[model samples]
Target chain A: MSDTLDAALRLMRAQAALVRRFDARLGGLHGVSLADFTLLLRLAQAPGGRMRRVDLAEALGLTASGVTRALAPLERIGLVSREPDARDARVAYASLTGTGRERLPEMLATAEETADELFAAPAWGERDVPVLAGLLTRLGGTGLRS
Target chain B: MSDTLDAALRLMRAQAALVRRFDARLGGLHGVSLADFTLLLRLAQAPGGRMRRVDLAEALGLTASGVTRALAPLERIGLVSREPDARDARVAYASLTGTGRERLPEMLATAEETADELFAAPAWGERDVPVLAGLLTRLGGTGLRS
Candidate 1:
């Protein structure tokens, strides 16, 4: 494989391992997948703790229908709620519920702890995080943009 | 979020986008998902184009059952085959068939092309590839070991 392909494959594999770790911890402790945590985190970062469905899809690199499907479970669990736009009936929003807000800090703590452990000690260098973040941003992984 | 958590989240999102792109192309062109392509590529790289099922699972970051479930469709499609260990009947190996070997180059070309496009142009700097790959390796991405 070409260098680019080699790197892309590595990225995929590494991400898979990372997700499995995150899911195990997040699911066992918080009853949330990494995906759910990401959704809640994004909502928390948004103004009024809500975002338009289309915008959320764009930010997460998912389709509009995918965003809807992802939101359904969170909505059912009362961790998220839907709001219809008053003027434009076609427009809708996803908002983090009070329950979601209350629970998110704990989730964030777990995720952060998991991440710190993953990158700690002999495995990672001091300079690695910024460099990796910059590289990921090039692939449209703009993280936690307020 | 801490810098570590931010980078981790970015990695997750970037991988998701990359997988979707790879899946769309690999699936449309080769009738294979990225996961299937990764399995085939790994087998192709193995000595004699085969590996023990347990080892394959370890390399792919999947459970033993996941390897079996993933192999089922490929085995049905003739891209992969099962080999009984002659001495140890309890152990099984996965081998890339002749058809698989023949077809892999084309699949690889498609993957390489897709990856190239993703990393091309103003978005990607020349130094980005090596830096990113090194970072991914720290997360146990290891790339193509053979």
Candidate 2:
């Protein structure tokens, strides 16, 4: 039981390290951090490639203030734009801009490569990739605004 | 494929968030971050709760300087001690103190609870846990170093 528990810890750690490395490398290549990449990815999920700032924070499990700190750099870089919502003047909407849309393809490609490398681990068949991915996603608890 | 890819990324992000939460909570309880807890765990693996600093770095997938930085706080707390290796003046050794030994069980119990809470992902089982753990340990690229 203890041994298995150790394995779960290791699995989590290995995955975290890989993400950090990929984030640092790919992020450095394009002058963004992993946190920046994540924000962009979140924006990409919206209908017009954007989300409300508070929504993005909840999605990422980050405090609204931390989201603001991360967004400042992205906004400064022109990757994100915050404007008063047309329907709700008090709410600010964070939307991707021309710069963010343009840079995403490159980031996505780099992400794929990193995933490819990690998937090369033994017994990790190509098919098993989706299986594990499914388990993780359901476990991730995304879109739980309720 | 895109859906699955998103899932993989989500799994990775969720795992990172969970660990960070655990580290924060555990740090409050033990005055040690997860990284510090790991160093203590590694020290306990040595013949008599002692190992060379370089080896510790290698075992933890950390650069020597990173290990040095982590050691500073532990040494200050007297939970661990560092000394020049008796046989090799150039080598530094890290050893656990009586306080450290006494504290290990408490930390381990906290760790077990944290793991149980964080990695309670679907489809996980005791049988699959070791296989994943051993695979992740190897994935860390430290197999040859240890």
Candidate 3:
């Protein structure tokens, strides 16, 4: 394999490892997966703690139907709610519930703590984090501002 | 969010984007997704072009059940076959068929081309590829030697 192809495979494997780790930690402690945490976090960062379903799908790299399927469980758990746009009945929005807002900080803290440990100590140095983030941004990754 | 957390999110998003791109290209041309390609590639790399089901699961970061499910379609399509251990009835192995070996090169070429284009533009410098691979290695990603 070429170096670029190797790098691509490495990225995929690393991501799988990262998600497994986060899912174990976040799921065990917070009753949420990394995906759910991301959804709630995006809502928290949005202008009104809400987003149009299509926009949220784009942000999360999911199809509209995928977003709907993902939100179904959260909605059932009262972490998110659906709001119909008054002027455009065809438009629907997904907004974080008060429960979601209240619970996000704890989830964010757990995510941060897990992330910190992953980059800490013998494996990674101070400079590696930013370097990796820069490369990932080239691939259209977000969350740099946050 | 801390830079560490941001980096984590970026990794996830970037991986998703990469998968989407690879899926589109590989699926369009080869009728196989990246996961299928990886499975076949790994088998080709093995000493006998085969591996125990459990070992395949570990290498792919999937469960035994997941590996079985993934292999089902490939097996049905004649890209792979299941071999039962002659002495140990309990052991099962997944081996690439002649068809899989013949078609894998084209699929690999497509993956390489997609990966090359992703890192080729104004976004990435020559040093970026090695640098990113090194960082990902710290996270337990492999494929560096290949």
Cα deviation of B66, candidate 3, in Å: 1.0
lDDT of 3 by residue, A10-31 (tens): 9999888888889988999999
Predicted candidate 1 versus true structure: per-residue lDDT over B1-146, tens digit per residue: 89999999888888887887899999999999999999999999999999999999988888889999999999999999999999999999999999999999999999999999989978888988988988898896432231
lDDT of 3: 0.89
The deviation in Å at residue B9 for candidate 2 is: 1.2
Model 2, residue A120: C-alpha shift (Å): 3.6
lDDT of 2 at B50: 92
Worst 10 residues of 3 chain B by lDDT: B137-146
TM-scores for all candidates: the values are 0.90, 0.84, 0.94
- Candidate 1 ranges beyond 4 A from true positions: A141-146, B141-146
Please, what is the whole-model Cα lDDT of each candidate in the order they appear?
0.90, 0.72, 0.89
| Steric clash count of candidate 2 | 1
Candidate 1 per-residue C-alpha lDDT over A1-146 given as tens digits, one digit per residue, 9 for 90 to 100: 89999999889888887887899999999998999899899999999999999999888777788899999999999999999998999989999999999999999999999999989978788988988998888885542331
Q: Model 3: runs farther than 4 Å from truth?
A: A141-146, B141-146
DockQ of 1: 0.54
